[model samples]
Target: MSALKESQHLKIPLKDIEIATNNFQHCIGIGGYGNVYKGELLIHGKSTIVAVKRLNEQFGQGLKEFLTEIQLLSGQNHPNLISLLGYCDEGKEKIIVYEYAANGSLDQYLRRGSNVPALTWMERLIICVDAARGLNHLHHEVGKHQTIIHRDIKSSNILIDNNWVAKISDLGLSKLGLSGLNRSAVISRVCGTPGYCEPEYFSTGIVTKESDVYSFGIVLFEVLCGKLCCTVDHDGFQLSATVVKDYYKKKKVSEIVDPILKEQMSSELIRDFSKIAYRCLHEDRDQRPPMTLVVKKLERLLAIQDVLLKAAESTLSDVIKPAHPLVREGGNASEIPLDISVLSNMRDFVKYNRLKQFALRALASTLDEDELWHLKDQFYAIDVDKNGAISLEEMRDAFAKDLPWKLKETRVLEILKAIDSNADGLVDFTDFVAATLNVYQLEGQDSERWQILSQAAFEKFDVDRDGYITPEDIRMHTGLKGSIDLLLKEADIDKDCKISLSDFCRLLGT
Candidate 1:
């Protein structure tokens, strides 16, 4: 028996499908295979919305495509891939159910329409990252023996959920890629949408994972240009051709970027994203990067974009003023004291006390608005050399007068190690702000916001996804080598040698 037959439990009754979909009353989408209807089902006593795709009667490749999709999607699962809830095959009727995506397809959002607003650069980056992760999983992480090539990868095939999470959909056109087999399968007829299809695949019926990479590159350009792959500008040039021409001709990023994004996005970010997209679109399939490398590049771009967004939203006044003035009215006004005010209110003190017990380096990475403002002058003062970053020597020299005793080189190194998240041996503005906020600003007054920030921070250190964090995990993420034991002991309320999410939240006084 095949894997599909073995997984019989995934089959849904025809009656159930009919009832869930209200007898196909609500048609939400139309695809080449069939019409997608919005449906609702009760599972675990909670209502869950789903998309039901009932195969079109007139569709020529009906049964073959349906079974192929079932075989492929049922065996694989990834956060970025559309989950195959179940399927129904009753006599001549066939239907497949999927998790409902509230935001619908990316193509809808990318194209200009009165119903949808233009997607911001951050949203586009996030959606692209999500899609890239799905493709990477399909190409590399599916299994050692098998690779799946999404033959018809296009903007319309990528669905966006309510939370802006993009899921790759439509596996009917996917081809199973068996490694070591030189000729996986040769198709007599060329498949896939034009413009996004790999040129080599069209010329020669040879399809590989690189083919998907080519489609993904087109999607990237679509995201950047906010135009379709086949779309030709007033000058009669395709989107890809126009972008490449503009890039090589030394056109400014503002010239190539979507007009809507030009004002909001930084030039450097646009250039970097364009370079990656261009590399993916390389004529030589061998020169194109694998999905793993593509994912890494997108992740880096996302990080830089995040920092730029945060910095843009912040100003100096947002930093909380210290209760005791850091600068005196004397000639040494340039020197700002480093002492953070201890909360006198019992509630606030309790919050601070709990927060101080954990390794705060990870939490420090996400500084609130006030913290960002507070670090501006402090960062400038500490970065005495004005080298754009604070080295160990600069840090120690800045605190030389504040310490009762002489600052030790080892102590300065410890400070640097804690805030230098990238292990670059220096603290940048973001790291500096995060460290200062983690040390001084985090308190019980804004318990709700602090809770959210602290939880995110906890998740950052809890790398294993076991809902509990250990000393080793803390040490690995925060570079708190010797201090992990102390943190574990303080935060590990149940003494299980691990910190549960609840324990972590409580420890932050949230």
Candidate 2:
């Protein structure tokens, strides 16, 4: 037996398991190790559904493998990882219980003749990104000095939760990295499913984190092509081989993408996604990008797709009649022309909800006169040429020294464009004040003025209509130069890297 102690709290008595599972009346799935049954257990006076996997006594998993899974699951906690509720080990019976996934495994959806509804390109991308994040966490964030590799990372192992969140399940083949141990390659017996296994690991019986990356690449392509990794073509080439061959032949990405995605997916997105998958499938293990990089690239792709989707929506909205007045015409509000230029900027207007405006006012109220004066001085410092307005070069140069996170040139331009709302390519003191009003003092009597200022501030920072201010959103839309991590540390109460409206209000002592 392993030295790891069994978690008593997570140990469910076999009698309780049998009762919860109704004497194993509902077998939902069968795997190489056991049969999974749907069950319900009462906890803290409340009943919750769960998946109970009972090992087949005749040909079940060995004790060591069972222990390894228990040890791994007992300590692991992530939104994208399957949660182990408890386990049952009584006499000759061995079983494990997991938080039930309502939508089942991803493989069921990817199968050729499956009856499940087709997933859109965006949905597929989101699922893949979610799975990559989970795998990245496993491979890098397990402990301060330890890394874990999910040796079997295929479609069936990725379970979809009720909220469409993809969770990495089935850790039976996982290998934990020991501190100070050589992780260049693990000399283990050949394991993992065919087609998904890394070529190097298969031939040499050596495994590494890169092996998981290789398998993920196969899974990625399977998601893209809507076929299993092992599915063979008429000419006998496996799916991966066929796709790679077609890619080298300069076949258009649209031609290679699954037909179901043709209507909704853009060629640009397919091309970029295909490029990432191709790199992950590199024959040389060293050529495959790490999971962290994979996550980053996927996030960028998703962000781009989101922007494109929004642009398309905005365009469609323009063609349709306005459900509500496009411009609020009242005491001080002007009836702005509903032209193409104005329609194109609808994303900016949609971001300024009442809650965000209130939060901005609350934030502004926290600043004293001295702090407000200091902010003005800081803005003047950026107007280096002593001109009345700050140009893009001035903003970029100022941010280069002041910001903890480096801003790309495009991001700098985006920020400038957000602040310079007049389309004059210059940000005057008025624009500066409008953008940073959330950090300036607001007089008690200036309620109406504060409302206007708050609206401007809300529109300036909340670039996305997600009702939260993320560091990335700030970097893309704000001229404020500071450590984003430090900013998030101060304002993101949930530590989700985004400041919610309530959190923003709370941070301002409102």
**Clash counts for all predictions:** 1, 0
**1-510, model 1: which lDDT tens digit per residue?**
274586688888889878988899999998887899999976546788999999997988877778888888998889899988888888878888888999999999877553798899899999999999999888878887788888898999999998889999998888887753433556676788988887789899888888889889889988988877777665574676446646634745456567898876655456667767766777888667778878977885676566456545656322222232345335332465443221111112223332342335456666565655445666776777777798878877754433332346665576677666677888887666545543212542355777777778788878988888877887776566565565566567688888888777555532
Worst 10 residues of 2 by lDDT: 333-342
| Quality of model 1 by C-alpha lDDT | 0.72
Runs in model 1 deviating more than 4 A are 1-3, 179-185, 232-238, 241-253, 317-510
Shift in Å, residue 63, candidate 1: 1.9
Clash tally for model 2: 0
| CA lDDT of every candidate | 0.72, 0.69
Candidate 2: lDDT of 197?
86
| Model 2 misplaced stretches (Cα beyond 4 Å) | 2-4, 179-182, 233-238, 241-251, 316-510
TM-score of 2: 0.63
* Worst 10 contiguous positions by lDDT, candidate 1: 341-350
Clashing pairs in 2: none
